[model samples]
Structures are given as C-alpha cells and as structure tokens.
Target: MGDDAPVVERVVESQLAAFNRQALDEFMECYAESVELRIDGVVAASGKEALREIYARQFSVAPVRADVVLRIRQAEWIADHELIEGAAGGPTMSVLALYRVRDGLIDQVQFFGQRVTE
Candidate 1:
C-alpha cells in the first residue's frame, strides 16, 4: 500500500456513505470536476453536471443503495464488489466498480453490473 492508500479508502468510503444517504452534494464532493463514469467500458457520464443529472434522475425515481461485498485497494485505485438494491423496483444488481482517485477525489469510475436473478 502507498502513502495515499488511506486517503483513497476514505474518499471511496465517504462517497459510498453519501450515495446511500442520497446526498447528492456530498456525493459530488468526493468526485473531481472532470470525473468520468463508465459502465462496462462505455462512458456513461462525464463531468459533475452530467453526473448530477444522471444521479438525480435515479434518486428521484427510487431509493437505491449499494452494499459493498468486497474491496481491494492498490495505490490510487480501489475496486469494489457491490450488491445494489432498491433500484426503481428492479431486481438487485451485482456490480463491480473500479475507482481511480486523484488528488483525494475520484476522477474516474468503471462499472460492470448484472441483474441478480433467482
């Protein structure tokens, strides 16, 4: 682990807490202004404005929360295996997210997810 490992972990943890609380502003605080969000290698949202728009819509529709099942950290990167629930009445989702932290903020995130089926 590098010197910034704790910083990286704290940032991610804060973001997760903010997300679970639906605190958009607090959530955004953990992200960089030029943040990029990717879903399955495809860029979904770029910049804070876009992120706000996307998350706001989701927050308005339903209460969504993600529980981290596993986490791996190395230097400035953090990987999380998450189980997400309460997404607009849809089935729970199992998601793997890789976050890249820069200057104590998350500059990029790549997500891979699948709906859980019985």
Candidate 2:
C-alpha cells in the first residue's frame, strides 16, 4: 500500500457509503457532469444530472443496500464489483456494477449482475 492507495480507497468507500444511503447529491460531488452509467450493458443513464436523477430515485427505496466489494482505482478511474440488493420495485436482487471515473466524477459505469436463483 502507498499514499495513493489510501486516497483511492477513500474514493471507493465514499462512493459506496453515499450510494447505500442514496446520497447522489453527495455522491455526484466527485463526478463530472458528463458522467455515464451503464447497467447490464444497458445505457441506464448519461450526464451527471441525468445520472443523479437515476440514483436519486433510489432514495425512495426502503432498506436498499448496495454492498460493494473488490474496488480498484487508477488515477481518475475506479472499478468495483458490487451488488445492488434492491431495485426490483417489488422483488429483491443483487446486481454487479463497474464504474469508470474521470476527473473524480463517474465517466462511465457498467453493471454485470444476475438475480439470485433458488
């Protein structure tokens, strides 16, 4: 671990913390206005304001949790494997999300996830 390691760690941690709490206002603070968010290969959102709207709506979810693990950051980019425990609108699920950071804001986000099967 080096000095930069701690800084990257904070970026990852802060992102997850705010996301779990649905704090896009705070979360987007570290992002640029041209950010893009992709989930499961679908263009869920683009642009900071638009992305914010996508995430902000999550605030309405009760008991929502996005448990994240294995985060790696290089310069302005941070990649992570995460699980979105809610968003089914009626059912619970876990989804994988990968974020690409530029200028401290999310330049692009890709999510790879599957529903937990019985």
Candidate 3:
C-alpha cells in the first residue's frame, strides 16, 4: 500500500456506486481502455468494449433496480492496487474484487463471486 491506495480505492468506490445505480457508462469511466477482468480465476473479459458487452448483458438480464442494495464490505490496499470485497443483495451475492489502478484509472480487475442463500 502506498499513496496510490487512495486513488485506487476511489475508483473502486465510484465503480461500485455506478453498479448500484445501474449506470453502465459511469461504471465504465473508472476503467482504462485496455482493462482486463478475470472472474473466479478465469479470464472473463479484456478491453473496454468487451467489458461493456458483458455488463450490458448483465444489466439487461437482471437490472439492478432502485431497491437493490450493493454494498462494499471492505477495501484494502495490497501492493499497487486495492482488494474490494462486497455483496449485492435482493438476490444476495458475495464478491471479492482485486483492482489494479494505474494512471488514475482501473487497469485490471480479478473478480471472484458466489451467490448466497439467505
């Protein structure tokens, strides 16, 4: 963790807010053009376009309505990035997100998540 931690955390926080609002464009603003994401150890998406496609599909399938609650349980800095863990409820899910932020934007993210039953 270093001074970059704050920048990393801010980007993650903004992105989470965007997710809660179901604002794809704002969500995308946090990422770099060449961003990459790995989901549960699998390389899920590469580049902004792919990211847009993936999230667009997600929102269309299960749009996060106003009632849905997206919460960030923690944001911890380790090395050059921040590890963000959270849950989205109203269909509860747990998520661990590793975000690599560089040059003031999220350059990469590794995500692991599971659906939880209440």
Q: Please, what is the whole-model Cα lDDT of each candidate in the order they appear?
A: 0.95, 0.67, 0.68
lDDT per residue for candidate 3 within 84-104, as digits (tens), equals 223222454555566777787
| Candidate 3 Cα deviation (angstroms), residue 117 | 3.1
Off by over 4 Å in 2: 1-5, 72-77, 88-92
The TM-score obtained by model 3 is 0.73
lDDT of 3 at 29: 97
Over 4 Å off, model 3: 65-91
For model 1, residues 88-113, the per-residue Cα lDDT tens digits are 98999999999999999999999999
What's the residue-level lDDT of 52 in candidate 1? Answer: 90
- Which residue pairs clash in candidate 1? none
Order of quality (TM-score):
1, 2, 3
Provide the clashing-pair count of each candidate structure: 0, 2, 0
Estimate TM-scores for all models. Answer: 0.97, 0.75, 0.73
User: RMSD per prediction, one decimal?
Assistant: 0.8, 2.8, 5.6
Off by over 4 Å in 1: none
The better-scoring model by TM-score among 2 and 3 is 2
Total clashing pairs in model 3: 0
